[model samples]
Target: MVASIALPRLMRIGAGASRLLPEILGQLGLSRPFVVTDPYLVSSGRTDTLLERLASAGARGTIFSETVPDPTVASVEAALAALKAGDFDCVVGFGGGSPMDTAKAVAVLARHGGHMRDYKAPRLQDEPGLPIVAIPTTAGTGSEATRFTIVTDETSDEKMLCIGLAYLPVAALVDYELTLTKPKRLSADTGIDALTHAIEAYVSRKSNLFSDGLALQAMRLIAPNLRRVWTDPSDRAAREAMMLGATQAGIAFSNASVALVHGMSRPIGAHFHVAHGLSNAMLLPVVTAFSAPAAVARYAACARAM
Candidate 1:
């Protein structure tokens, strides 16, 4: 069978790629942008720094910083309200997974005129939404690279997993410098999450040659560096490796797919309000152990790759 791979049209990856956000939007002819982010980034002043850089380029953006840890339909609607209130030309996702996912949702819902539930899998939304520029502040989740997003339904208490090229960012600006300030626990949890994405992508039934190469490379970059970043947050090299590994793992899984751990972990996150990466970390070992028997050789290959 032939495999289809989808990714952002433009990707800028390095220590300070985020500084190019204004240029990216200018190149895309998107003058008016609305930013979707979480309160933490706003409180920490990272959001302000980014806005300041954009202003220097003669671009000012409307900010919606109320995104929650587990983004909800309510939160998405709130963002949509912001999107509708302004004549924004594009959406900027400028924080971790939550803000990125929220931005993706707002981009789609604002155009299609529907609720988040209308686009949940197995709904394939290859049609485009508003142009989105994703700048991930965290090293994990890889939301900037992937063609997927997750938002929860408050009424039903379910994590609605949305898939398709529409959810993918039009452009991704991945800068490891944004992750230097991440706390130790967040560093550890998100590192494990990226590792799990690599392993599952390599082992999934949907795996193919291109995804295999990416997954293995992601594991190679993540395994040794994950611990280093957690122990010494100031280690620039380790942080860069982890950030690149996370993006690779995201590309791997976006082209392939995640297996049991992600499937099981989503429900846990929906019920308990756990962080997406932390929930993945909680279930990675147990789910891998249970599924290993069915694909021993594949699992062994992952072990050797790591």
Candidate 2:
């Protein structure tokens, strides 16, 4: 069987890649961008700095900074309202996973005019939406590279998994510099999340040669450096490695699939409000132990790679 692979059309990865957002937008011929982010990034002045850069490059950007953790349907609808209020040509996801997921949901809704639940899993939305440019401030989630978004339905308390090419960002700016100021807890949590992504993708029954290569590489980059970054958040080399590894893990899982850990983790996240990565981290050890017998060589390979 042939494996189908999907990824951002353009990616800028490095120390200051986010600063080149205007350039990426220009390359895509998009001028007006609706920037979606959380309030913390806005209060931190990072959002203003990005908007300033965009303005300097002659791109008009509108901000929507109310995205919540886990990205509720109400929040996505609010963002969609803001998006529809403008003649924006693209959406810019300017923070971690929540903002990115919100941006993806809004982008699709802007074009398709539907509720978030309408795009849930088992319903593949292949049609493209407004272009999305993802600039991830954190080194986890890899939402920038994946064709998936999760939005919670507040009424139902369900974390709706939206899948399709429409949810994928057109361009991604992966910069390790953005992760420098992240706290130790965040570093550890997201770091383990990335490692879990790699391990799960490698052992998944849906794994393919291409995804296996990426997963192995991600594990190699993330495993040794995860603790180093946690120990010294200022370690540029470790941060850079972790950032790249996270993105690779994202691509790996997107192309292949995540296994039991993710399956078990999502409910914990939705029910108890545990952070996504922390939930994954909590479950990975036990999940791996239980799953190893079925994929012994695969688990062994993951151990060696890590």
Candidate 3:
């Protein structure tokens, strides 16, 4: 089957990929960038490296570091206010899915001018947002490349999954070196999230030839290395492999579709405030086991692949 896929015009992956952010911005003629990240990245000095990179090129940036996990509408609002308050010429989404998603929201909303819910799932705002350079600290969600962002509605507790050309990053710097210091549980959760992406993409009713290959190779790379990296946090080889797999799986699922797991997990996350990835993880085994009977041959391949 045929499907639609969108991506960043620029994606830099591998070790030290982040170091090129300055060069990336320079080539694009972007000088004054507003950096969007969470306090965690700020405290951990992840934001510092990015700042240094910009400074190296004599570029200036203002920091907006209040983003929270599973970013909410309120959080995006705060970021948008900050963006407007600062005289930022461009934007940099720096961190994991939450902060990155928040950055995307800020970029889009700043230009588009409206409440987040005003641009919900059924709506696709094609207006280009501010130029956003994405630098992903975690490999999962592939928010750096995809055009989707889930921001929670505090009043209704709905995970408002937003889609549009406005959400796509203009550029991405995916450095595996960043994941080496991540704690084990986060590593496990995001790794499983990547696995879920691959599996869902492979089994999705919307699956296509292009996405199937990405999903297959994603599973091949991630399934083995997930545990290895989880067990030995400092395992560079495993860490690197898992990071690549996570990004690949992100590409796969974004091109195809994540079915029942995401559909059901979103509700659980809304109700229980369980981390989206954890909620998805807890449901995976049971959902797969129950659904395995529907396509025994394909599922057997999945089991073997895992």
The candidate maximizing TM-score is: 2
Candidate 2: residue pairs that collide: none
User: Model 1 clash tally?
Assistant: 0
TM-scores vs. true structure, each candidate: 0.97, 0.99, 0.96
Relative to the true structure, candidate 1 reaches a TM of 0.97
Tell me the deviation in Å of residue 301 in model 2. Answer: 0.4
lDDT by residue (tens digit), candidate 1, 42-98? 999888888888888888888899898889898899889978998988899998888
Across 1-306, the per-residue lDDT of candidate 3 in tens digits comes to 447877788889899998998899988899999999889889988778778878988999788999988888888998898889878878898889988899888888888898999999899877888988888887577788777888999899999988887888889888889889888888888888888999998988788888888888888889999888889988988888888888778788778888888889988998899977799899998999888888687677767777
Off by over 4 Å in 3: none
Using TM-score as the yardstick, the better of models 1 and 2 is: 2
For each of the candidates, give the backbone clash count: 0, 0, 0
- For model 3, name the residue pairs that clash: none
Error of 1 at 9 (Å): 0.7
> RMSD, model 2, all Cα superposed?
0.7
Scanning candidate 2 in windows of ten residues, the lowest lDDT window is: 153-162
